[model samples]
Target: MESKILVVYYSLEGNTKLIAETISEKLSSDILEIKPKKDIDSHSKMKYLIGGKQSVIKEKPELIPYDINVENYDILFIGTPVWAWTFAPAVRSFLESTNLKNKKIALFSCNGGANGKTFENMKDKLQGNEFLGQIEFKDPLKNDREENVEKARKWAYDICKLNIK
Candidate 1:
């Protein structure tokens, strides 16, 4: 049987969104954009200060309504921007609220610098699911746009081509 896939992501500066979109396009999967009810301005200088603090404290902010049925999809591709060396708070909120079990998960992160502990932290929080794969992109909206897109496309293809359980 063919596997169903969903790409859920939270992107403030379009970096993570680009990666998510690329992966979705590659797999022809559904996409979910995670929006926080309250969000810090990415253009503001205080964004780092505020976002970093929230990430450090592992704050799970409220998310705008998103329609999804975890049971409807067999594979999940979750993407998020690396904030404070970790995944965004909005992702935390969604993950905590959603009941995801016995699902195949693939993680992707977008960061200006290093992905740091982003994937590790997310993996720790996301237990019980079989992770198909994980990939990281650097400034998808800015640096090496074509390369990043190509990488995401190939990665998504490879993951989906794997034996689906």
Candidate 2:
């Protein structure tokens, strides 16, 4: 199969979705949106923070659709919102459902704080895949969507060239 980059993510309040779209547009790659079987109402920040853990514990992530042969992708740009200081439950589900052997996997997180442990939690979920690199944005950048996307694209290029040091 021919190689391509895949930008996969789950967005709760449109920030992450916009980031994903911008990266996809710049990279000209396929985009996949990960949706949960039961949508969590994110209107209340406190509710989203609490409900995310419950959803993870229940193992109830469901995607609206996914058809690309993930294995064929040379580089996988996995994006997610940091929930409970970790990878989003829907992203966890997507990672679990796919086998990422021999593929380069880079992570980009739209999160609320500077806690670096977010990647640690992701490491626990993606135990077997080759972790390429990670780029994270705190809550302050929600208004600077274009700038964030440029950063993500640069990060992707760095990963592809093994320049993430």
Candidate 3:
């Protein structure tokens, strides 16, 4: 039987979502978008200040209830947009709330500047699981959208080859 897979992510400005969707499509996996109950307005100029502060402080924003059952998936591809040198607060909330032990977890991040400590911080929180792979994409929505998408697709395909065999 094939290992079940899921791509979970939170995108504030469509950067992370572009990569997440690409990976999900390539792997033929279910995708979950993490939506905070109270989300920051992307249109606001203060969004960087607000989102960065939340991420820096490690705040767990309340999430809109998602119907995904994580236990059903054997491999999880968690993606995030970098904020304050870390993953988004909504992704933080999901990691803390979900039961992810022993799962084959892979990570991906999209950032305008750098992934910073996003992978390290996520791995620290996601202890006790086997990491299949991890990848970082820079500005998937702008810099090179098609290239980034193709990278995500190829990365996801390679990860499955390593894990699903």
Ranking by TM-score: 3, 1, 2
**Residue by residue across 60-154, what tens digits does model 3's lDDT show?**
99999988898899999999999999999999999999888999999999888877899999999999999988899888777887888888899
- How do the residues 1-104 of candidate 2 rate in per-residue lDDT, one tens digit apiece? 54578888888877678777877776778988888867777787676656666545745467666677888777778887877667777877787788777766
How far is 130's C-alpha from truth in model 1 (Å)?
A: 0.7
Runs with alpha carbons beyond 4 Å of true place in candidate 3: none
> CA lDDT of 153 in candidate 1?
96
- In candidate 3, position 111 carries an lDDT of 84
Candidates' TM-scores?
A: 0.95, 0.82, 0.97
lDDT winner: 3
Model 3 is weakest, by summed lDDT over 10 consecutive residues, at 140-149
Scored against the true structure, residue 47 in model 1 reaches a CA lDDT of: 93
Candidate 1 lDDT over residue span 12-61, tens digit each = 98999999999899888999999999988989999989999999999989
Count backbone clashes in candidate 3: 0
Model 2 regions lying over 4 Å from their true place: 55-58, 140-143, 161-165
Which candidate order results from sorting by lDDT in descending order? 3, 1, 2
